[model samples]
Target: MLNIKNLQVGLEEEDKQILKGVDLNIGEGEVHAIMGPNGSGKSTMSYVLAGKGGYEVTGGTATLNEVDLLEMEPEERAAAGLFLAFQYPVEIPGVGNMTFLRTAVNAQRKARGEDDLSAGEFLKVVRAKAKALKIDADMLKRPVNVGFSGGEKKRNEILQMAMLEPKMCVLDETDSGLDVDAMKLVAEGVNALRDGKRSFLVITHYQRLLDHIKPDVVHIMADGKIIKSGGPELALEVENNGYADLLAEVA
Candidate 1:
């Protein structure tokens, strides 16, 4: 469902490139995990895919269902069914969670030329998803991520994913800072969203989260490129033996 070819990206003013000839493909109904150490450019890949600012696509192309994804704006990308769940969720002090979600959902809907959701209907659907994701109603009424625990923030991210129902989803270190219970909850949310028409690229450091949300393919990234790609066993190997062994082969 998604294709990234020889992707090279860097900051707007800097000559140094962060992503060097990166290539990846994610198909429908498949889950892919990307594991790497710090400064490996995994997050940069996510940001570039999502069309965030300050990053210039120096080379390569990314396509979604045969459409040029890199040509679209961030909001346009969302309308094209691309979702990225951030590793760090920013708290909006005054913006209520539900309000923010409604605006986002409606904006996407409007962009797609669909009718805006009524207040009652929007609440019903979002509430159902929140409940399934184990997110409380009061949390929805509160400001987005305001004073929320690490687990709560992660759950909120998953809840947004569930509500958005994107064609492609990227989870950037969703397992970070989460405890055992929160990790399970976050993984379950991902599992429940799994379907034949959707795809996911889950970026994580450890293999723990992969235990719950088993991926069809696992990739090891170093520097700016994906060096090794394999099955679920690859994640276990990384967990047990660490990336040192794999890095040697790739380097």
Candidate 2:
């Protein structure tokens, strides 16, 4: 479970506020989608939650299972069950995908006071999870995201999610780039990880991703605040009518 209360964040250098007293609570096993306009602070919320730099929390608190998240480093947050799939995955030239993944997994495990996975164990698990994401051996052997197609990069993100199996997954615009088939493939990979124990926060611009992920709740964000919360139908409204009317009504 994740809980945020009166959360306010701003750019560190600019000192300009982005999230203005945003509040949200996600129960276990729930998928919540955040739909908003370009400057609505949706990605800002995700970045802050993942402990990315350049943002300062000016007010309020966020917690995961009652653990204060704002105090942890990014890797500490990841070790505490936070996984963020970026809108634009960066390329790590020369770092094999498998090596990156194994290092990450072991680092988190060590952080949590668990032993590193044996080479054999690591290989077995990565292979199984990669196969599910349709990641071929060749792809795994290649440097992380280096020269990967957009779809492949996104799929690799999902594979990382699967391998980590974090309790809370925050996907920031994971649907930003993809063909119809590629989108479907990525969605299927996401759906396959859906069980009654993990929670998801899906931040997306379009309802097309929601059509596949099928969030349990949908939220409309505007002007750095969540103005309305509803069911899946809310996404359809945005899809059909756009945010102009919603913004007008809220205004």
Q: Provide the global lDDT of candidate 2 against the true structure.
A: 0.95
TM-scores, one per candidate: 0.98, 0.98
- RMSD per model, one decimal: 1.0, 0.9
Candidate 2 residue pairs in backbone clash: none
lDDT of 2 by residue, 138-237 (tens): 9999999998999999999999999898999999999998888889998998999999999999999999999999999999999889999999999999
Candidate 1 clashes between residue pairs 3 or more apart in a chain or in different chains: none
Residue 114 lDDT (model 2): 92
In candidate 2, what residue range of length 10 has the lowest lDDT sum? 126-135
Overall lDDT per candidate, in order of appearance: 0.94, 0.95
Q: What's the lDDT for residue 227 in model 2?
A: 96
Model 1 lDDT per residue over 157-207, tens place = 999988888999999999999999889989999999997779999999999
